[model samples]
Target chain A: MFDNIDKTDINELGEFGLIKHLTQTVELTQESSNKGIGDDAAVLDFSGYKTLISTDLLLENIHFDLRYVPLKHLGYKAVQVNLSDIYAMNGIASQITFSIGLSSKFPLEAIEEIYEGALIACKKYGVDLIGGDTSASAQGLVISVTSIGYAKEEKIAYRSGAQEGDLLCVSGDLGGAYVGLQLLEREKQIYLENPNIQPDLEGKDYIVERQLKPEARKDVIDLLAHLDITPTSMIDVSDGLASEILHICNASNVGCKLYEEKIPLDPMTYETAREFGLDPTVCALSGGEDYELLFTIPQADYDKVKGQLDISVIGYITEPAAGKEMISKSGHVHEIKAQGWNAFKNKS
Target chain B: MFDNIDKTDINELGEFGLIKHLTQTVELTQESSNKGIGDDAAVLDFSGYKTLISTDLLLENIHFDLRYVPLKHLGYKAVQVNLSDIYAMNGIASQITFSIGLSSKFPLEAIEEIYEGALIACKKYGVDLIGGDTSASAQGLVISVTSIGYAKEEKIAYRSGAQEGDLLCVSGDLGGAYVGLQLLEREKQIYLENPNIQPDLEGKDYIVERQLKPEARKDVIDLLAHLDITPTSMIDVSDGLASEILHICNASNVGCKLYEEKIPLDPMTYETAREFGLDPTVCALSGGEDYELLFTIPQADYDKVKGQLDISVIGYITEPAAGKEMISKSGHVHEIKAQGWNAFKNKS
Candidate 1:
């Protein structure tokens, strides 16, 4: 009763192909939908204001290994990660809907503890938990969250808004979250090899917390507002600094030169990178999950936000013909490439 | 380092505990959020209109076993199922955010076909597909959709609006979706036992379609508006008619008496029940996935909607003291109990 049709493997299309295929068939029915399917968030015209909507999914083994990550922090981080996208667009998150797929083996209290972490994050971030779905899973846990926020039409930021000769700025430190992950994974291996031996996590608290409990940089947006400086372009640092910089450059038809010394790196992150025998500079450039804001401001407004926020001027936007490159502390120039975490290739 | 903390499973707290834990920590920083967390959807006070947000998740094994289901139909049903909730609350869906957790085993074409099906439903319902997340899963496929809609504050309907002596009404035929599930499961088993046998499904098209491609009762909402009659309370018939009736009775603080004969049953559903040795009345009352509307209307406005829509007046609201019962065709009375599909209990 079944017709023979050749099925193509999902890996063949890659993540981009799957998204394009699924969204290509959609037609907008509402006039309020100004833009959909090709940005950090879907933009909607909410009368005088613009609304932004975005979603993210976290799978158990693939996104977070439960062996080292506690349920509560996992829950809290899930909501925070999604809100980071809204903050990336320079918007205030107003509400969120969370959905979870749980295995039947999970006890009731474990789920509550996860929510407890999520609740703490929500309270800290000033957003509301609106509505969601809960269901049973066959194997592992899955959490999906969609966040909605609003901003005035003029205050909204997009990756495509960067202009030539714009100043590049970054908030907070980089490489810490990635270094934290390394620390956790190392401790996990040590614990597995010998259960009686305790993990030696001395003086790595900052990096470890950066990985386990990253916060959305909503405060940066508030600070920009207070300083009366709106960014020409912006994006959240979730997929490594190099990849996000490339996104801004590609979207704005511009190139950038990032100074190695200007890239913010926490002291703990530097120490941990040396302990792991990895280059601290490489970790700062290509390591992911910083949850910090990467943005560009016009030359005229650079002084306005110079000291208003905890930001560092990393580079300057250039003409697209110049290409995206980074200037090292040793006076050597290297082309930037994205080697962010690819789940398909890395999944064990 | 490992901490000696007590471990608890998620099932012990149930769905409500998880929601409470997550929501209790949420802080509403935005003034636009008038209500959050305890309603069908988050109510955002956006100027003159109130925006409602809700989300639902459908997992392969938990929500639908693809062994007996088609991919395209499953995609269509997923969108319809979530929209059904928005319609039940007397709101029009404006936009949707879809997230899919797909296994690498499925071909790219198969995933595209699923989206094709979703596109069809989106057009029919006048909702825009705004944003979504695509990720690779280790096992089965999962789809989570969040819908946003709006309604005038005065026109919004809630489960608590039903008054005593109000009439209980339902739209279209019931129990067909449940019977349809049985028929499909039987055919699947037969085919699995003998691959050489050609199964026949032509005569069961109606029931099969009901099961595979159920549509949300958006027309009923429009019809009520056209007829100048508003439901006192409403909810979609997703978790079986009996279970839904109890929800209304419990929420509205009233009792109901359902007449078994008045319950609508399609001819295909009746024949399928007999073939399977199941009671037709029980199937009509306790079978789910109908996506029909179960609502209450005041007696004073009954004449306005009597023939305006495909409706059946199967019962009436009574004083809470009377309790919930069903009157059989042979003049027997039985207490109504909900035995709807419970994902938690059935997961094992």
Candidate 2:
């Protein structure tokens, strides 16, 4: 029997408040645990290696819509999403455990299809599927994946490592995933309006793929090794480029300056944004689920990756006193504010 | 884009089939993963210590009914359930990551209450709550917890270690949790049928506690260490005593003869079963969620624990040809069959 606590609404505390309250009471006893909370992953000092642990939860309806999203892609993306956190730490994922809560309404075949997707991702990333549990759910499906990775103590990256003058870089293009989502939702609406009509998804392949099957940037980590360039700080862009930049700035106690003209946006993303009557630059800055690698490298290491096709030098870290600012194409400076995906704010 | 496979129903392969299929494709590349899948936990050779990893998933409606279960108890029980797996391996849990899929209907306060339960369990068990994800769900709530633990290589226990002639021992009393569940379900039905009626639950305290808050027997692991005895094989009684015994026998390649008279059931469980017109012995053998440790120990070390108050030596391991049998009080021998909880079983 538990003593009843003060009946306070969870919405008042918010997601961040709930996390802080839960973690505030946890005391770490293991000396091997170098860092316990408040990072991409928990850092553990194992023998000869530093291990990183991270987990992510995806729920049906809220995280994915099975009506348009394939089960296989859902599974693959679940594993990839967790692996991204480990990648954010500049660590190579070694093992993963996947736990699924299945609704009784789901058929056995649907569960296997999900696993088939997860299997493909695990094989692609060279990680082992170690252990997991399966249980029936009362409602929609839930997938939670925990990935364990390891790196040399010195090679490990953290969000708080950025220093003033470090060049900020991001891998691949941005805004595609967010725009892809818009395309899918639009198609869903059209189909709902007329049952006899088949939805068209012509020529929006890149953005569509970005939304449905986002890849973790493990390649960037491998490339850094080959170029002998270790990032001063790193984080995966899951919550939009703007929000991620703000996180690094806040964590590292510094400010940043971004060049609007330098931000990477695929031509398809720009074209689609125009079609939807939205600004392409705004989508690139505030769109979420890009799954790109955002990192800060020393100025001396910039030339090593300057000519790389997938890399973009979007900004530079600045002293805290300078504040975070984005330079517009017209040469005006504007403060950057995070308007990333917040399910709470969006929910009716 | 994924090549379309005729969607198979999950019921076609069953839970075991799905697990086997998912694990079949896993390829372990890390040398540190000494063993992966097909065990209580994955074994990892992390430097000088051996690490074990296990995960469990709990879904609302299927796993618990909010009508009778409180949020804090749900949170505490979630962690306790995962820790039981580590205790099954005779290891000390060091870290845990909890991922929750929250439905839109849940207030933020409800989520916090769940975390309060988790934090209480973590502190009680001396394990750190390291990392986790909080995501919105379209349907009911889901909680997935992964526990990481450590043990000396030589001290590690596995389900495949039992030898012929070893003694099968179980900790604490059994069948109470199952009976407790029946009482709660009955109360729920009564309350649902008539909201104005105040149900009676005066003498069912033990059974109700057993059902609502099952304890992981980490103390048994400590007791074994104090007595200088290590189990040849072990597993937690989650899927009932009969099911766990079969697991030990199958994994160890041995048979067992359990004496029904030797099986320990709490007095409350016996009385409740009679009141419900159910056989007490059947409940003891097939009822689940006991969270008691079931283990096999060599004859040489039997005397070390013979005087233990809470342990019951219910059976003895034999050659595989002997088959699994239970000797009834009337001297009649019957082959033991696993009739544990099967989520896929047809229900009226």
Candidate 3:
């Protein structure tokens, strides 16, 4: 797709020149996007709508190991994670600003590869690339994606809107991304031990793809709208089910009772996770990077979501005095804990 | 000020706890800010208004050498540069998303110092700290700020709005940041050579402060509103004066003739440039990070802005065929070139 973009030096095109070259083909399709690119700031008219803004920062080696992660998938995932936040808010992402801090080791082609993936993702999601900053990093790559979306006021959902008796639900299966990550890590270790060996990954396509290129819950948001049901509270599961529900519980001043048997998991994820001697439930509870919507709805709306196969009711809300609890398959209740990633706390 | 915050391990609080601790005191004051922090995404209501969005990325050792830059000042300037872009479009910034990729080297206290500076700036500007993602960087510190503002439809300005015969104008003096950078670099080298001697920085406060904690031109935007003179075209001077003017010209499809005599310069900036064996005009034209607003107004608005104290009419727009030219102090006309900071091209 990026024909004749082979070996040209980045310096030859310069910063502004390179930016102009990459975004030259970008076309603005949204009427609300009154202006896109080529300005001090992009002008957007979100009159009569509630605007949603979210930002995410991705760091190489810390967020993804570049040895196993392709540059294109990295760029695409950066956008997906940010847009997932918007989707979790029950909003439609309309624009995104992609800023990158590239290190000296990267070539023009490498940056172009990343941009190509970002552009393709933006096109697929109907979001226009607006304004962003491009700079050189002294070390590794830094990708920052800020996604903007809009929604009708009545359709929006907040994490603090959950109430007692609301059904806790999740869209799509969990733990697949975590299982895929484990598979990739195993393959990488094998390659490190023997570079000449062609490592195995033939039938592990499902987990690998889930780990490498997780999609945002845009369709789930649309399907919810189509079903004429708005979630009482919502959040994307980027930091595992446990962390997210805890967040909602704290925000809403409510307690949740989660059922392990009701949690959705792919067959491959379960089998592969057990093969690695890891509990699949533990992986889904704390592994993260799923990008699936986790939400709650009233008991009245539970029947409406029952017909949807992708939707799974995993738990229900309770009074704040009850505290956040999770029930195991054997019927033991345990308090939920947050074991999410902390940048500063990692190893120090 | 942040005395008691000493040596708390970041992991002890975890990611969400750290973020909540840092932003707990962030009070939302903007009317358009429907929600501030603690959500899947920020909720902003910009009904009946056109919104402006701008983003900027700052990398360690690339944008600033932390050996001299205070973490607090770095944090303050990061938000300023991003807000300046929004102000250039004749918009009032209402919300911002601040994302940081901090390395393991920084302690909890160090990160809080940076956050303190950012919060102070946001409070001063009446912008709500909306939503952002924080992650661990394997390398150095990376700060990315995305500012969102609102502008009245008729009051907004664009780089492509300049017409023939429009008067080019600039707010505040230029080249101070470049001069300050030179002084800091000289002092750093001296310190490296001899640790015993305190580096000479007695009377260079004006320039040094300009570089370290440059403020966004929010007052200039207010002044323009007071004068009832909307700029025909505008751009913030993140890039050098020449480069920014060229951007405006390219966007507007018009030529410019900048008068060297009319370019405003602080006395310190001019004398410091001469001491460094550099031309003041060249410094103003090519040196960047001034964070001033450069704009154009119709010839009719000249009288409206004539009484403005800090505004300077440095040039006029010309026909496209005339091309971009600058008249020197000695009355020599030459084509203005883009010698701005091109991260990749600078070395090659």
Best by TM-score: 3
lDDT of 3 at A257: 98
lDDT (tens digit, per residue) of candidate 3 on A145-203: 99999999988999999999999999999999999999999989999999897868889
TM-score of 1: 0.85
User: Which candidate, 2 or 3, would have the higher DockQ against the true structure?
Assistant: 3
Model 1: chain A TM-score against the true structure: 0.86
Candidate 1 chain B lDDT trough over 10 residues, lowest sum: B1-10
DockQ, all candidates in order: 0.15, 0.17, 0.79
List the global CA lDDT of all models.
0.76, 0.78, 0.89
lDDT of 1 by residue, A37-105 (tens): 432123333565556677888887778988888778998999999988888878888666667787755
Model 3 clashing residue pairs (backbone): none
Best prediction by DockQ: 3
Q: Give me the runs in candidate 2 sitting further than 4 Å from their true place.
A: A1-47, B1-47, B346-348
User: Which residue pairs come into collision in candidate 2?
Assistant: A10-B108, A10-B109, A107-B10, A108-B9, A108-B10, A108-B11, A109-B8, A109-B9, A109-B10
lDDT, candidate 3, at A100: 84
lDDT at position B141, candidate 2 = 74
